[model samples]
Target: MKESIISVEGLSHKYSSSWAIQDIGFEINKTGILGLLGSNGAGKSTTMNIMCGVLNQTKGSVFINGIDLRKQPELAKKEIGFLPQQAPLYKELTVDEYLLHCGYLRQLDKRMIGKAVDEAKERCGLTHFSKRLIGNLSGGYQQRVGIAQAIIHKPLLVVLDEPTNGLDPNQIIEVRSLIKEIAEERAVIFSSHILSEVQLLCKEIRMIDQGKLVFSDTMDAFNNYVAAQSIRVEMDRPPAGEELLKIEGVTKVEFLTARSLKIYFDGDHEVTDRIIKTSVHHDWHLREIFFDKNSLDEIFAQLSNYTKSVN
Candidate 1:
């Protein structure tokens, strides 16, 4: 079996009297991205901070590449790169100078520092801005510099907390593409509060709510866990409630407007096909029909219940 790149066991942290995270544990192998998901102030940052050795956990252990993070921080951190929500940058320095500084901070050999900085710059598309002051770079390029520094040491794992938080749509796309490339050869912990962002980038997701890990599984498993409860249907010539109730598998029908309705199902297969056929037969003029994705809050509630039930 392949060894895990990072292992977190029974991790817990307290800020004064309140616990920020409790008994949080998970492991990631040395490839692919794991999305750490939560709402704002849901302990996502606390967890990332502890895992990246920025803060000491009040309890439990974090092992990066089989080395204890708290015990052998210097050695273990050699295999981990971290970019927190706020980019750590010296805006006054040129991109090249800043990257060279990061290389030294990461403790790279003097002989390898130049090559490492160059490679990191190339990988992050910062070669053109090598001489430009980081302070003068756009928000997107600044984010790139942040990411470049994270990878400057070529760590086995990279922890990024909301890398796309402040970027525009175009910049978000660019950073996402860069993340994809970075994860190809190493493990990455991508922390974000945005549910859609996690859905788009990660194959697996870990959801934290109210200082607890409520769900930890693959994205496919998460989708399966939360069964779609309703579907939205728009019709031109809509049918009455009495007429629609005659269909199979539909438990409830809520009309939002004269032409739009919400249909609730009881886990029945082919409900859409049946609805489509009925619409054609009755000339209800079905314009569009699609299942409504469960909201993040709804999913959190469901997972909370499951966690309670299993425990």
Candidate 2:
């Protein structure tokens, strides 16, 4: 079995009187990219802060690589690279200087600091802008610099909250690719409300709503979990609803647009094969026979709606 790099058990957080996050639990294995998805004020940032040791947990515990965050914060943090939603950059400092400073902050040897800074800059494609002050760089470049600072210490896990929050299409693509490259060795847990971004970057997803976990699974598993596969059959004029419902495993049938009937089936072998065999027997001129699967956004919306209804 793969070792879990980050573990949260019965974790909860409160601000004064109200709970920001309540009893959220999940784990990220090493070398995995887990997308932490939620709506605005859904406690994504609050959870990340607790994991990174920036804020104390109100209840329960978090362990990174078996090191308790609250017990040995410094040691636990050494295994983490955190990039918050806001890019924390010293505007006056050049990219190279800021990265070097980050290395020193991590207690790297003086002799190794320069080499580490260069490596981080190279990985983030900031080698050319090393001497440029962060304030002068474009927003995308500044974000790269921020990412460079985060990985200067070569931590075991990287936590980025909304890394691609506000960027142009090109910039977003660059950052997404950069994230993919960085996750080659270590685990990455990035929080985002953008469903498309999560779909593009993460192999596994953990969705939270109203401070509670709604779902956790791999991308394929998630799609399968919430998918409603409809077998759309095209014919000039087919019998109406009840005729199709007579078939085995056919749950519901609806007329979609013109000259098409979308039949909802169990998506099992027996049902799909039966549908095909039925079509052949009927000699219906089937223009199309395919499953219309749902996208990640659609799945998320369904889960969100269920959460609201339950609450």
Candidate 3:
């Protein structure tokens, strides 16, 4: 089993009588990216703040690398690097100066701070603009500088809250690539409202809604959640839904527009073969037979609606 680097047990938070997050439990393995997904006001930020030691959990506990956050706050926090939705930066300071200051604040040895600063700059692709004031840099470069500061001390976990919130399309791609490159070593806990971004970047996804966890699964399992075991059969004459559903291993069928029938199988490729055999037996001219792919956005929406109904 993979060792869990971050663990939460019955973690809950509230504001007066209202709950923000209730009974949230999950584990993030080392060296993997976890997409902490939720819509705005879904308590994703609240959960992240609690995990990073920015806020005390109203109930339950958080463990970072086996160290209980409540019991050993300092030790647990030292392993975490947090970047808020707004990447807090010293506007007047140059990128290098700010990063060096961050390294020192992380308590790196005087001799090592310089080396760490250099590494952070290079890794974030900020070396070219090292001497530029953070306020003068473009939005993308400023974000990079923000990342450099967060990783200056090389913590075991990096938490980014809406890291690409305001970036242009090209800038978003650059930042996403930077995040993937950074995740090669440490575990990354990222929160975003962008479903496609999570699908493209994260290995595992934790979806939350109205302050409660809705589902947690790997990308493959998530795909399965939205995807029916269906084969898209293209033919000269599209079969009716009921007619196709009657085929062996087929649980359901939907007419997707005109010539495409999404034939849902009860199980494996055996159903696909059955569909093919049945189609041939029916004298239906088959053109193409392939699995129907589900987009992450559809799955996200379905889960969101389910959460709302349960709440």
Q: Which residue runs does candidate 2 get wrong by more than 4 Å?
A: 1-3, 236-284
lDDT of 1 by residue, 1-311 (tens): 65579999999999999999999999997599999988899899999999999999999999998999999999999999999999999999999999999999999999999999999999999999999999999999999999999999999999999999989999999999999999998999999988888989999999987778888999888877788888899999998877877889888899999999999888775898999999999899999999988876678678767666765
TM-scores of the candidates in the order shown: 0.87, 0.86, 0.84
Clash list (residue pairs), candidate 1: none
Tell me how far the alpha carbon of residue 263 in candidate 1 is from the true structure, in angstroms, after superposition. 1.1
Better of 2 and 3 by lDDT: 3
Q: Which stretches of candidate 1 lie over 4 Å from their true place?
A: 232-237, 242-261, 265-297, 304-311
lDDT over C-alpha atoms for residue 16 of model 3: 92
The 10-residue segment of model 2 with minimum total lDDT is 267-276
Off by over 4 Å in 3: 1-3, 227-231, 237-284
Best by lDDT: 1
On the 0 to 100 scale, the lDDT of residue 190 in model 3 is 84
Give the winner by lDDT: 1 or 2: 1
User: What pairs collide in candidate 3?
Assistant: none
